[model samples]
Target: MDFVLVHGTTQSPAGWDRVAKLLTAAGHRAIAVDLLTPRDLPVEGYAQHARDQYDGERPVVVAHSGSGVLLPAIAEALDARALVWVAAYIPDFAGGRSLRDEASAVLEPDWIGVDPTADPAKASEFLFHDCDPETERPALDSLRLFNPAVLAAHPAGAAPEVPSTVIVPTRDRTLRPDWLRRAGRERLGVTPIEIDAGHCPHLSRPAELAAILTGRA
Candidate 1:
């Protein structure tokens, strides 16, 4: 299947390095996109590029992290066959609630060090809930700094027009499994698959994640 891999907040095209390699090796076409965000444009503006790039291909959209906000827009614009969300932010596409607000409200008050004031890169731990030290070390170290604006916008959650798959990182603290399901997956006909990993499954569990994508698991 042709694929469009959308990285989470502030993530450039390099973030999908591992995923792109795996998908291509499996004989699938993958287009890893880097939307221009953190600029003066609105989230809708970024969403437009995601739509325009897809052309006429019914590609599978794999979204991670803060890119969750764009799902509604992208899904609406493209003739999407399927979407696989990896530890992504699932928001109310209609009410337009920021993914950040939804995640903060869902996480219990006990989880501290969330650092609402800190940059997204420094707060990487919140996304990788149960990842090993090795898998997370470099990712956390190279985390690109971006403002919270990506997650602060209203995500079009009224309803998604396409079928989607939501892979919940079981240990994800950034976008909790429960919240991800409720926020959008269940509404969008997505079969929520639970994986024993942290936020970035493509980075740490490429084989398992690829299997799921290929329908072998």
Candidate 2:
């Protein structure tokens, strides 16, 4: 099966390198997209970018973190076989709330900053604390600042009709596991698949994450 991986904000396709390697070894084509560029575009533009890059037949679309908001449109456009949310936000379609509102409600006091990418150290602490120093260093250096307007904008269109799965990282410091479970159930109507990892499981537990994605876990 083909897997289209959409990365979170402030990150690039490189973040899925390890997980993609594992999926490829298992004979599945894994395509990781970089949604950080053209930072001026809104959430719809990111969804269009993802849809434009996919050239396979009904691939399973997996989105991480903030990119989850784009899945509804991407799935509809691609006629995706399934939608997978990895430690991701399941937007409340009924509420018409933006990603920024959800983020601000949960922002840690230390996370307060005008520019999220300005301090690499704090970014690492928030995102890659569980990653190995060697792996985390380059990721930190490559971090980019995504336009806040994307988060502030409401997700375009309603949730798609594709079957969905939510992967909740139990050890994620960025998003609480309980909140993910509750949100996943309330919004997506699916129970989450729990993993013992941090926010970036593709970096910290690639093999294990791949197993789940490949139906071997």
* Cα lDDT of model 1 by residue, 38-78, tens digit: 47456667767777666657778788877776766676566
Give one digit per residue, the lDDT tens place, for model 2 in 1-217: 9998888776777888889899999999999876665456666677677777878888888888777777777777778899889988778776777777777553344444534477777777887778888888767765666555666577535766778889988877776678789888888788889988888888888898899999922
Q: Name the candidate that leads on lDDT.
A: 2
In candidate 2, residue 40 scores what lDDT?
62
Question: What TM-score does candidate 1 reach?
Answer: 0.78
